[model samples]
Target: MYILLALISAIFAAIYFYYKQSFTYWQSRGVPHLTPSMPFGNLNKPWSIPLVDQVTKQYKIFKKRGERQAGFYLMTEPIYIPIDPEFVKNVMIKDFHHFTDRGLYVNDEAQPVIGNLFFSDGQKWKNLRQKLTPTFTSGKMKMMFNTMMNCTVPLQESIGQIADNNETFDAKDVMSKYTTDVIGSCAFGIECNSFKDPDSDFRKYGRLMFEENAIKAMKFLFSLSFGNLAKKIGLKNMEPEVAEFFTKVAVDTYNYRIKNNVKRNDFMQLLIDMMDKDNNGGQKSNFLTMNDFVAQVILFFVAGFDTSSVTLSFTLFTLASHQDIQGKLRQEIKNVLKKYNGEITYDALQEMKYMEQVINETMRLYPIAPVLGRVCTQNYTMPSTNLVIEKGTKVFIPNWGLQRDPDYFPDPDKFDPERFSDENKGSIDPGTYLPFGEGPRICIGLRFAMMQMKMCLAALLKDYEFRMNPKTIVPLQLGFGFVISVKGGIWLNVKRIS
Candidate 1:
């Protein structure tokens, strides 16, 4: 028993010394850093506190100290945080080549679905990005416009009923269903009918993908911090059941389309066409396998449904709190639709410039992706600084902090859409407002997400006026998850516009 205890003591001592050495990394490099603690490092109560909140808090602290850059630790792993927009611009846009990869955990051999463009790196990412770029073009968005509009019918009906009944409902839940149906139809070419059948497979699996628990949080941190080691042990970024469901859906959709020679204007058809082209005579570099196809499909569904829903919910919540802004937005929607013969067409949606401003303001206040992540692919010196960020180092851009900084946005907490008006928007710094991120690696589905959001808001705002429900907690407490979400949910009362 004494021998065993000595061995255990030795192991613990070694771990303590190792962490102590690791914690001094940023200090040795002449960078400002927050003090790190055992096990969790600077990430205190990670499972309880949202990662975005922690990072944003850190960003503010460093910025207030008049520092342009700072460092923090995620466990023993060092993360570089750039407080200056110039550094952010260099990392994301001007010097993007050195930081092309997101540095996420990807073990495609074990979890084939993890091989999607979002998680991939280097040559594979370049090839896949090249092939998929055409899929999200403005012309393609125009093609998928009608399909997006169709999904809003159920949304309008559900909200209209709530308006007529003058009932308070969870805006998050309603928007989630709306986006689920939209993504299901546009990405999978299936009608989700999430409003009618809340337990539908698409909705079930979509929820499963983003559902966070302590175990999931631990797995995510583990995989992110020790990516190679996790990959060696076959750690997966997604639940097996969720991966299997999305895979089967993609397979069934692809096979049915190919066998019957059916072609639709949605994303699945475009993917199928690409696969068919690759199989026939496409260049080897551009070829996509079945795993590749399913991976992209899953990426589309996950990103498409969740982020847009969160943005829509927050937009409604903001508009509810500011009745004057809501009224002006509703009037813009009405005016834009009037010019299009009272039909919500793609062109008409574009003409609603103020609606764009409203959404931008909401995203600024409550960005769905509050932080942007990247890994240094090569040793590069930060411009105008003597320090060099080593290769493989993780870097975080505090999207939430930058967007809400009083320096960039005057009266930062206010929900004023005029901040994004054409006359004033250009004055805002380039790298500061990253609701959809910036640069080549910026969100590929941004236009699609914007269209879905605008269509939903345009559809509902035309007939319904929403107000905050007392049930909603004021000074909204955000929840822990991959995206920005309310702790409980955003509840709003709906009344028909007379």
Candidate 2:
């Protein structure tokens, strides 16, 4: 018994000494840093708090100190959070090559279908990104616009039903259904009809992807901090069922398209073409395998589904809370549609500039992708500093912090769409706004996402009015997890704009 206790004590002592050395990494490099604790780096009870909250808190602290950039740790791994917009631009755009990869751990063996453009790194990412770039082009988006417009039929009808019944509905849940149907049709070339049947397979699986799982979150953090070690232990960020389901759907769709000689002007059809390109007298080397093809489609659906939904829901919430802004948005939508003979066409949607400003303000306040992560791909010196950011160092740009900082955005908490108006928007500095990120790694589907959001918002605002439900908690308490979700969902009462 005495010998066992001594052995345990010795092992702990060794671990303590090792980590103690790691704590001084930033200080040794002459970089300003937050004080770290023994095991969890600078964080105390990190697991007990949401990463978004933690990052935002740290961002406030660093900003208050006027730090251009500050180093901190997540476990033993050092992370550099850049408070300066100049540094942010340098990492995101000016010096993009040095930070090309997001440094995410992919258990390809476990979740092979997850190696999409979003999570892929190095040459693989570059190759995939190059091929996928044309897929989201304006011409391609124009081709898929009709398909997306068809999906909104159920969205409007469902809202009409809700408004007639005078029943309060969860805006997130409602908008998620709309997004699911849109993505299902556009990306997978299927009819999800989530609005008609909320328990549809697409909706069910989509909800599972974002549902808060403590074990999953911990594993994700562990993988991010110690990627090599996590890989050795076979840590996977994607749920097994999710990977399996998406893989099956992708394979079945691909096989069906080939067998029936079917073709559609949707995202899945583009992927199908890429896979069948060799047979269609195209380059074999540029082609994606079944796994690669499926991965991109899944990413398109998953990433676009949740993000667009959250943005739409939050935009409604903002509009609901501020009636005057909502009224202006409705007027813009009404005028634009009248010009196009009441048709919500792509060109007409673009003319709704005030609507765009509203969405921008909503994104600023409740960016679903709260933090932008980048991993240094090479050793590079930060401008005006002797600090050499070593290769493979993870860098975080706290969008949540920068968007809300009083220094950059005066009256940051106020939901003023005028802040994004033509007259006022130029006053805002670049790099301070990155709801969809920037540069080459910028979201390929930005135009499509904006169109979908604008379509939904314009349709609803033109027909109905949204007001905050009594069930909705005041001040909007954020849910614990990665995404900046409202806790218990945002409930809202709907009324027809008669």
Candidate 3:
């Protein structure tokens, strides 16, 4: 009985000590904060509700608390959330030298896929990025345009079949298949008929990439719950099977092409040429290893397949909901395509200014990375403050909340494509808009994603009219897994316009 009483007293004392430690964090720095209670710290919501929603709520608190930045704990670790956009811009771009890494571990030796651009940091990232930049230039994109177009022809045929069958389809699912085919053809230099055959290798592997498992879920929670510690255990940002399958696919494809003297004007070909094979473009001979090849193809897959597919899907759904915007976009597409003889050529796609605005608006509301993450490599003192944050502080920019903030965007809940209009957009603050992120580490595949998106939209809008199906959830909620997706997907019924 005495031992039980002693144990209860010890537990309460531990609780009191934790609160004392957490509460003293901000008070000592002269930073303002709501007093934390017991062991939950300031992030109790994250433990109780959906994690994304918890992040969103913290964004609200930081924004309204009138703190330029707030001191808080993700459980026990201290993190700073920059409330003001100016501070965010400064941390992410101006002071980038102090925070060169995303703070995520890259166990490249243990997990090969983690060596890719998304997770790689410091000198290694710089070296790899320098070598790969020329691969996606305007000239190369033009060379690859025909490959994307060839896949689109199949997409159109697939749509025609769907329309004939009165299939009430999830535009998201269909677009995913279209993107899978395009990525397979362009990235791997192989034929993947995802539109005709659901069981294609590309399709299977793509599913493997995003499908969730208990291990993935636990790591996800742990990473958010205890990020730095989670990295020590060698948790990979991508699935192991996905990485193994892709590595094998890349090796087999490289071997088959070399042995058979096969060549295609695609990403794989460029990578091989860089290896001193047939070597187009008079590029110097450098041996490209399997990691080098897989990294390049994975970039194509990561950016090409998912982000574009999700962006295009949401745009279609948003346009269906807002007919006025849809009508204006259709007019722009018709005018631009007609200028190039009803074909979406490189130069012609550039002329679709209004279409660009609409896509920008879509990206604004549904940015693929709703938040930007960076880790401080050196101690950072909030501008004008004497408090120095120790190195390794995980910094976050909640683009989802900032983009939707009423101060930055009036009537923040409304879908207003003109928010991105040239005249109106120029008046808005530059730091407020970051759909593709900011600074040296912004998404490198922005142009590639846009070009594919523009082409697909042009083809679909030219021949079809889309309206929301009964299956679509109104005032859509963002899903919790993989990439941000509209819950229940964007279901649409189609009518042939031609």
Clashes of each: 0, 0, 0
- Residue 203 shift from truth in candidate 2, angstroms: 1.1
Whole-structure CA lDDT of model 1: 0.91
lDDT of 2 by residue, 1-498 (tens): 999999999999999988989888899997778788877887666666777777888889878887788888898888888889999999999999999998777777777788889998889888888888889988998899899999889999999999999889999999998899889989999999897799977887888888876676777788888888888888777778887888788789888988999999899988777767756678765445777888888999888898899889899899989999899889999988999999999899889999999999998988887888999999989989999999989998888889998888899999999999999999887789889898889988999999899989988899999999989888898875646688778999999977
Q: Model 3: per-residue lDDT, tens digit, 1-498?
A: 999999999999997787677677777877655566545566564433444555566778878877677666666656676778888887878888877777664556666655777777777777667667778898989999999888789888878777888888888888998888888888888778887798876778787777654566556656765655666787677777778878888889999999999999888888777765424545342224567668777867877888889998988988999888888888888888787888878888878888888888888888878767788888887787676867877777777888888999999878898887878888776567788888888887878888888888888888887888988888887765556777677899887875
In model 1, residue pairs whose N, Cα or C atoms come closer than 3 Å (at least 3 residues apart or on different chains), thus clashing, are none
Q: Clashing residue pairs, candidate 3? A: none
Task: Name model 3 segments beyond 4 Å from true.
Answer: 1-23, 34-40, 45-50, 212-215, 224-234, 275-288
TM-score of each: 0.98, 0.97, 0.90
Q: Give per-residue lDDT, candidate 3, residue 287.
A: 28
Each prediction's RMSD over C-alphas, in Å, is: 1.3, 1.4, 3.4
Using lDDT, give the best candidate's number.
1
Position 67, candidate 3: lDDT: 66
